[model samples]
Target: MDIAILVKLTSRAWSLNILASMNSGIPGRQAPLLAATSASRTAFAQSLDHLMQLGLLERNPGHGHPLRPEFRLTKTGAEIAQTATRIVQAVPDDTEFALLRRSWTAPILALTHRPQRFSALKSGLITISDRALSTSLQRLEDSAWIEREIDATLRHPFPTYRAVNQGFAVNQAIALVA
Candidate 1:
């Protein structure tokens, strides 16, 4: 997905509300800031549900109010949020990654040393167009060189690409031949 689109979907307005309310130790109630933007209870509920599905939000059971639930980021969700922030900051203000098919082997390999979201991987060095990035990631996945978990923690979400076991086995075989 495009970083711009991702940012819009995971806006500061939504993130702050979830983080603030959780930090404030409130149980299940929407933060005042989010409540202002939502206007209606239904809208707020829908927004909350969307975040939950993204794995960026979670609910905590309220001791007193069964209906009024507390929401917070799951570990994976928090990592994605932080990684998103890094991606935003890392991209040059004036330039979008325009090149495609340019070798991303170096950066991709480095990120594989420590699994990270696609955004984080992109942020680390190479800047390629969204399409190219997607294609490359898909190719890696198809090759069984990487695996992604649909609902991972904040520290690792989205396409947290890693060296597949098969990849390692192949590397070992190649090393032996060499």
Candidate 2:
């Protein structure tokens, strides 16, 4: 599994909840899923749409909306859901990985395994906005997962960063997703 795919699966608050409902063998399609997850309609629908788009779910041709609709896991979806279930076991409320629920956090943390200047991280992550990158780095620093150091070698001094704890849990999560 690509780390990016895992990141998206974990990023949304209810994404895992929706997947867990489907994997739990509940019936009555979205109604049961919504009830089981207790998520608002908008969040439930959005998560369901994302799961379907990820190919983790497919509409059951046997049923359709208006009267009723059904969904089933694709083989790939089942595999991922099974893996996700295991990942879920390790995280209760998942506050342990709160940072990971944001898209930029994991990639930023992964790159911070080594000391890196802001420019190096921004260039390496390509497609991340300057504001977002700076924000993610600041959050990580605030979380005590990383810290800044003065880059005295520069003509004009600048700060570089390196992971402090490097978050063993996050590393384990990356392995699980893989």
Off by over 4 Å in 1: 1-28, 31-39, 62-64, 83-178
Candidate 1 Cα deviation (angstroms), residue 60: 1.1
**C-alpha lDDT (0 to 100) for residue 97 of candidate 1:** 16
RMSD from true fold, candidate 1: 15.8
RMSD (Cα, Å) of model 2: 3.9
Q: Residues 1-178, candidate 1, lDDT per residue (tens digit)?
A: 2333343343322442343344444444665535533335665566567668767767755432456555666886565545433332332232221111124422343345446677776675445666756676676666665576564556754546765544333223222312
State every prediction's TM-score relative to the real structure. 0.33, 0.67
Alpha-carbon shift of residue 166 in model 2 (angstroms): 9.5
Candidate 2, residues 1-178, lDDT tens digits: the string is 5656765675555666666656767763888888877778887788888888888888888686855678888888877776655544544555655565566766666566668899998987777789988998888888877788997886999999877664434445445655
Model 2 CA lDDT for position 24:
67
